[model samples]
Target: MLKMMTYFQGFSGHQSVPVTVDFPRSPPKLPSTSEAESETSMSEASSEDLVPPLEAGAALYREEEKAAKKKEKKKSKGLASVFSVFTKGKKKKGQPSSAEPEGAAGSRQGLDGPLPTVEELKAALERGRLEAARPLLALERELAAAAAGGASAEELVRRQSKVEALYELLRDQVLGVLRRPLEAAPERLRQALAVVAEQEREDRQAAAAAGPGTSALATTRPRRWLQLWRCGVAEAAEERMGGRPAEGAEVPESVFLHMGRTMKEDLEAVVERLKPLFPAEFGVVAAYAESYHQHFAAHVAATAQFELCERDTYMLLVWVQNLYPNDILNSPKLAGELQGVGLGSLLPPKQIRLLEATFLSNEAANVKELMTRALELEAQRWAQDMPPQRLDGHCHSELAIDIIQIISQAQVKAESITLDLGSQIRQVLLVELLAFLRSYQHDFNEFLERGKKLRSYRANVIANINNCLSFRTSMEQNWQVPQDTLSLLLGPLAELKSHGFSTLLQSLCEDLKPLFKRFSHTRWAVPMETLEKIIATVGVRLPEFSELQDCFREELVEAVHLHLVKEYIIQLSKRRLVLKTAEQQQQLAGHILANADAIQHFCTEHGSHATWLQPALPTLAEIIRLQDPSAIKIEVATYATSYPDFSKGHLSAILAIKGNLSNSDVKSIRSILDVSTGVQEPSRPLFSLIKVG
Candidate 1:
């Protein structure tokens, strides 16, 4: 782990100290970062540390019970005979106590013997004879009460000096044991806690005996020992943080990871080994948990002030926001241990949000950089005129595969950290991807327009179309993307795909140009071979389209179908025609129907799924063929009903093609189409592309 400035020090045990944590204002720059090897070793140690052996815990508990019994027995037999009257019974009025036994009056000074040494007091506390230390506690209280009663200050100081020094030494020992429970004996902790409890009781009694307005000394003795106890627990937590990750060291692991493991193990020990030693009012478990939590949060904030790599940042975020609560604090071993405890986040909400935003921003930037590089590489390949790679006889580009890998890998990695995070990361990637797609579309369109003379032009165009189609399909399947983002992504891809299809179709249409020119009302006045030629020219190019993906192949075929029908309609509508008789109208209508059948058969045989478009041309030819004015009007209205995009210009062109319809009759039929309502628009409209005069 990398270490930084030391923090969370010098906490006071008697009062709560607020831990101040400052976060870095800016996010760390994105770099490929590696995890430290120490984390593995720490984790290995933690697994064994989390649960102490049942036999060991039970034995320790038994030993504590035995020591406590011994202490009680010794107090009853040894100290009780000497100090029992002082604590329990009322002193006799004007009479020596009988418990002092029948002896020489000169021997009655045993209680007045030399005050106990610090070593003796410590040894007694160690042996759990807390009663042996009670005399000193009484003396300290007596000196305070005397001072309050206006005793000479010098006399009070002379009397309290040695006793106060020994008691202070005892207080330090108790706090020392608390400061390092992992290394201290369970007996030591029990005795220390008992000493505090005894002092509290003695102080309360002294206060009662002195009464109000006489001696505030008992209440005002500062209770400094309790304050030192709190400071000790906080120091214990700080020590467990593994101390400043060896200054100048490269953080091979997440600092928080190591810190979390140490905290968890120690807290487990506190619950299992130390909780029973303290009074319930002391909240031993909660005290340690809060200290550990506060220190952990402060350390993390300090670490955040440094530049953390992506892996470390994510690890840090996960531990604070997810792992600490779920794995460490509420672990099965410590279940129900912290309920109702007002535990807070390891990092405040604001810091967590900033961390998350930084991660997302870095990821988005990385995606953009990768996408840009991919395009640049592809452009280099294009400049060098490398032929497109083919997959199963279809032109192929690695652009889609590479770009998809980038986005998907980021998503999976983000999800590995957290689910809610995955969605956020994906959104930023999508935003970058949207911009990348636009660039792709522009590049592809430019290639199609100007790279026609290049050897790989046709194949590159097809491959790019395949890429767009692939991108669109992936977005549709990705559940993490919001609907609006998905819609935004699909726009450029759809345009690119349509443009590619048209580019391919225009090449085919170019070959069919001569055949379309041969189409005319005059030419149809005789039997013609134009329809056969137009179908043959397109049928040859239809096989080239099979190289597309199944979805794209079908779409391209449908586009081809629509284009053919629209072009055929244009030829008919603009052709020189004057069929003034019913016989001539029937002849022209028959030719139109034959052309419709040819185009429809060519499209279907080529795997077009646009069956909706097959009826478009045939229905128009039927209107041209009908002679009954009412029948003609019905057919025109039917056409409009089926294709809402069927406009007035289309209807006028059809009637003109009939040639026998008078101006008044044309106007009357047009009204039928105009009045038609409730027409459902076709999903792929064809007539909307046709322009007629």
Candidate 2:
């Protein structure tokens, strides 16, 4: 029967079954059986009896078992309910739920409490109490859930109020998270969130102060606010880490942003604030701001390393520039500072040129001072192993000129300048001038050689010349002219004039001569025409010879003209007799023959015959005494016939054919003379000599 009951009850057959079973009634009951009796009785039951009894018992037991299982499941479910109730009761012990109606719950919570409208919600948010409105929010949620179809007006207000309250609550929570003591918050998140929040506040403030009437306020607030942020970040960072960030620690992005904003909005304010606190940091910030303004951040970044007191350095440089504008022009240090700050690379070429001019100008005064400063700086830099600044070749040239000028001007002012100073100054000036000359010499040569315009070259050369001349004159007047000055002043001018004239002549010979030759061959009388052109172009102006004009005298002029004529005639006569080859002799003879009449006319007009006869009368008389044909010389005979009273020695010397010529040649000369007056015809042969003589 137990087996049957077990089978009916859905138990595995291997397990022993109990002989009695109990069922639920209106009241509960307990089964009465000893533990061992129940076990033995379960074993004695026969299969048939057990089967049928077990079937009936199993059916009842099965139903009872199902009921008990259901009850146990219910008990397990009730444990969860008990735990939830217990937890709720515990939580409620500290805080109680209010007894407000569902529709009014959100409003009664004090945040969204029946303050009546959107305006109140905003007011509540402004007052910063949105977190306290949880009850009113719950009421609104209930109202929305209950009115699933559509909300009534009152329900809508409750819902809206709930929304407003929740919004305020969220905003407050976000702000609270941001405002949490930085130390109490997680570092990364706190800093990031704080930055965002602070930025938002600044933006709002800026907007508020942005209108025309409020621009000053807006402008000032951002700078103050940024400084506040920087300080806050520094303080927060310090508090969190037990000190300020380690030296060279990367400034937090928040701090950098704060600084940037401050600089952008209120540069002066930031500058003022930073001036005292962290000078280097201020310098860096100011430099960055300047670069930002000038749009040269990239250049600055590439060129400079960030440092502690760089901002002060930058400010000092800027202040110096403003204080002494001329200093920037004169002092390379001012420019170098700007370059160090990355202004050099950023400045345009034109601006760079302008800066160069400034440096040159500033250095114009007391050049020694400028040079000494430059040298000292250079030495210091070298000693420190620092890279050089942005000085160029032009700077050196300008500095050199300035020094020379200073020395020159000082020497000029001194009544009795020392020889040493004068020598040094003169040497310096010469070197500088030479450098200028060397640079332009090629240009001047080109002008002379190619016949090009030389205005520019001339201008430079003239200026230098005038300067040297003035210096020399000054020295002479002061009666302190040094040997060197005199040498430079006098020697160079002569050399220059000679060189200039030589160069001009050589150019004429090379370039103009060929042209002249071509035109002379091709055109009628082009030689004379070209000669005139040459004279017009290069002939020294006679009027400009002031010394000659000032000392002019009539006797002097007459004596010079007479000497010139005599020299010309003597030279012509010598040339006529010196023809070597027969062809040259014949050529000369032909020229003499062709112009004989003209020459005779010129001699007659000038009374050259009368002058010649007067000097040779004695020589003619002596020659006339020797009437030898083979041994009586024909020259002696001709002289005797032409000037009977002249000496033989004089006649022989004047004829100049003392030995080689034959009698026929000497007689040919005599045939051209005018015998009646002992005078030779001016146009006739002045001499007759064979080629050998």
Candidate 3:
């Protein structure tokens, strides 16, 4: 029962059953600003990193408001109320005339085909100067009108052909500019490419900082978001464009890449660049993430396929997601367009969802797999083994560290992904490792069985104890994790090691159980060598087991003393008559006194255990020296009465050793004891219950 009690309480310094862990809600993972200075090793993120391009949206809203204000002021300030109606017609009349001059210029060039050369269109789009393409579009439309009107001449047909060829040549030129080397691409294109490229570099750094822990991406939710940074390109563009977009007759604000910043940069340069070929890139990046998500959601974690995917395919997907966040372009989104929403009204706030949901659905499944694997292996190695095996430290360490690595790596991504599964993984690993160590009880059983050769058993138990201790020490010394998670995961094994040690002490206690009986009639004082040998059991496993020495030593002396007293009483009974004469009595008593002196010397020389013998031995000596029958009877009765459980044979032995009592005297002594003990039956002896020698 003591051993069993120790077993349950050993791990925690108190009792607690293992629990099935629930995934904890991961708090919003903010990029650790301290990581730049600490082991996390991530790039430092100051508050300004997430600040949107300040001039992007706010300035545009104000400008549109200012323009509306200017228009209303002009209408009101134009004339007196009486003439306002007449001037309103004049204003309408003035609008068409404003276009007449530009139309005249278009008509004048109609004969010459006003066609834009391939060089002219490419250079304009690459520089994001879309206004330059308008005259060319105007000429193409005029040519189409002339052809449809059935008016064709030699030069008309020739110039029309040139305008017709402009379409493909213009498109190919734009695509070529879009596909230019990224560094040489316009600034806005470079900004998008630079941000993505930097994110990739940071991802690699995070992976390495995760150290030896298992990649926690396996347990990650299928959805993950990573925040992006701006490096002055978009803001500089907004500052130059005055936060206004140009479309068609002006610069076409291709909705190609819209920064989700407060001042959303329409990425006019990206517009001109990607406008020709954005859809193809979109289909390629989105297609893979979308297709993989279906298979990921369909499979359960228990399947081996899911395990394989979690370790391999999932990591690859993560790499892809890193390269292209969400697999969806972060250009712009359709919000509310039921009626008239003027320009900036459709501008959406930067989205706050995970950068991608492509990875979220399977996080729980991966979490489940880790725990399921741990519990399954725990059940296999402990509950089902035919003969218990020593805990394979290397194997279990790898398993524990694998779990740790998974959590650590996941944590690196969690700054963006919001993984709730990390803490649970660490907890399950702790429980598994603890369970593995606790299974050492079988080896302990073998250690006990080997106790006949006390030295060897002591050596074996000590070695096993130190092995558990060393394993725990190594774990504490090397287990790497974030401090908060580290606090929760480590120390479980230390408790198990402490428990194994306590059980070892208890094993020593058990081995000493029947040993006291060996000290019988002639074996009076326990031999010093024998007592020393028993005391040494604890010392062999010492320093680590140092605190238990007092307890073990005390129990040892009590066991030895008990056997000595029991055997001494019987030895007294075997004595030859002590009093044919006084000389004979003295000789017999002296021998017993000498043995008692040896016992006292053994106790004083060795340890604290024999302090109990100091007063007990002298009183026993006085009782043994008595030679008168009446005195012997008084002493025996007093001693037996004091120690009520002492047998009648014990008193008889004392009387026989003194040789001072005849049969009549013995009978008389018995009658006195019989009356004292309230003996009611005549045939029954006074100490009939005792196993008297």
Q: In model 3, how many backbone clashes occur?
A: 16
Write model 3 residue lDDT over 88-191, tens digit each, in one string.
22323222211133233334443222344433433333333222234445455565457556664544445443443333233222222223312233433332
lDDT of 1 by residue, 1-693 (tens): 111221112111223232221111221121111113222322433332111121222235446557666555654344444344343224444334323222322233344334454334434444334345555664564566578779875555444543444454455445544555545455556656656665555544545565456432223343455556666666666665745555664463546555766666666667777776677757888887888888987877777777888766766676666677767777765657777666777878888888888878777877788889999999777767788888987789999988988888778767755789987886677778889989988887777777778887777878888887667777787644668877788888889888888888887878877777677644665434877877777777787876777778988878877877877777777836656788777777777777778778878887777778777778877887788889988887777777888877777766776666678887888888657644566566677677676
Model 3 reaches what TM-score against the true structure? 0.31
| Root-mean-square deviation per candidate | 13.2, 34.9, 23.5
Show the lowest summed lDDT stretch of 10 residues, model 3.
1-10
TM-score of 2: 0.20
Off by over 4 Å in 2: 1-228, 231-265, 269-299, 303-433, 442-494, 501-541, 544-693
Clashes of 2: 28
C-alpha TM-scores of all predictions: 0.74, 0.20, 0.31
Model 1 ranges off by over 4 Å: 1-131, 134-159, 184-188, 204-224, 242-253, 304-327, 330-335, 350-363, 391-393, 408-430, 479-485, 525-530, 676-685
> Comparing 1 and 3 by lDDT, which wins?
1
User: Clashes in each model (backbone N, CA, C under 3 Å)?
Assistant: 5, 28, 16
Q: Kindly indicate the candidate among 2 and 3 with the higher TM-score.
A: 3
